[model samples]
Target: MVDTKLKFGVHIRRAADKAAKMTTALSRLMANTRGPRASRRRVLMSVVHSILLYGVEVWADSLSIAYHRKRLAAVQRRCALRVACAYRTVSHEAVMVVAGAIPIHLLAKERKEVYQKKGQPGTRATKKEESREETLGRWQEEWDAAQKGQWTKRLIPRLGPWLGRSQGEVDFFLTQLLTGHGAFRAYLHKMGRARSPMCLHCGDAQDDACHTFFVCERWAGWRRAVEDELGRLQPETLVLKMIESDRNWKRVATFARAVLSEKRMELASQGPASHEGTSSSEED
Candidate 1:
């Protein structure tokens, strides 16, 4: 209806249109069939977000142009929901937090700052003389302000070098741990594919990934064998952080994945159930 407004709208529409198409085509990819929640997120980031953010900084100036800015913001909000696999009812801020995305308007604002800096004369020369300590301080300040509550102080860098070189199963295991998705029956049940969160083998307690892998009586033998392979017992505290850390994550992955695989086979054979009276003493 608004002709002039429609002209600049094409930029965001192009990205949104591409994203909508990708979402439609890859709807099945959302089935959690991939390695772990981490794997799906990587796909979302590496593929979906890559396409969505292409040339998005150009929309920076649109912020001054109200109509174009609102449209641009709307597109990004929708994309964030899809990327996070959150319900449409979720707040855009919540969606962005989970997706590890910044608000598009803010992103544009940040890009505009960089653009202005690039255009300025002698800015780089001035910054070149700044101390490394000053640079780190500035970086820490920005990282501290990245998100609101939990990840506000969190610095999201790449996974460690060993993870880049890990095998497929290890990669999947790490994905599960990092994304906190794939292995958590509570999560899958919440998503509706699983019937219950309780361990089919142990039966008394909830079957969260941590419980099954480390604390479950059912998997003690497997855990011992895994520890033998790793030449050490993996600690329960800071266990998930092991994925990001260089502390024998490969061994953790191999062991956790073996347990996960066995659990899957067990689930498939026994069918998903929560039996209060039946408690198997050992790993399936």
Candidate 2:
């Protein structure tokens, strides 16, 4: 599917369209409010991504163009959002991280590298693993340097350990904590949907992710319960602690769900008048 200019734009667009349809067909399984997130991620990678990247090695170099990269990325972003149970407004980088999925461009490059090494002495599995490690390393470096999603970065400073977790699940509430794009007051103010960024429960400080999770006196009892079992909760070491064991992960997740659920209910009870100046546009 090459153009007169010998560009792979047609192929890329066709692949993206097919993948988008496949994603929609499988929407029930990958819907944010239903099904196991891990299973949804598997379906996305095996079905949607396979269709999108079919024979990617042949046209991998075309991904160097930003337009081509974004075309494919948009498809992957939709699937990742569902896998992470994240809001649509979440940044691509942050949602991909929370979803434990690699970037589409990097994956295409990895496949290309693996295909190039097919004739080498090593087995294909080993070559693919090597390419995956290289791609993940590159992604980690980019994540560290990214300026957007600072809230997510604070929680998950390293992507490797978070991706390797065998337990715990990424549901909507947990995604809210990780991405800081949920029903938080500060986030609402940024979107022009709230009059003040002050905490709805405490009314003393701006209700951002960090303040809600670690500093808010309103949730002091909940935090104390979690800290009693998980030792101490620090933003820098939170992910590490969560991934340490299934008990630790569930404990933290439960705390987030309890607190954030109440917060959501509180905000809803305030009625539409509380959000009088709601904006149609939202920033990443």
Cα lDDT of model 2 by residue, 45-93, tens digit: 5677898788787777743435588888888988888788877788888
Best by TM-score: 2
lDDT of 1 by residue, 84-164 (tens): 544343344444444555555555455445555676666665634343334334434544454532211121232222223
TM-score of 1: 0.54
RMSD from true fold, candidate 2: 2.6
TM-score (C-alpha) between model 2 and the true structure:
0.92
Give the CA lDDT, 0 to 100, for residue 233 in model 1. 50
Error of 1 at 141 (Å): 10
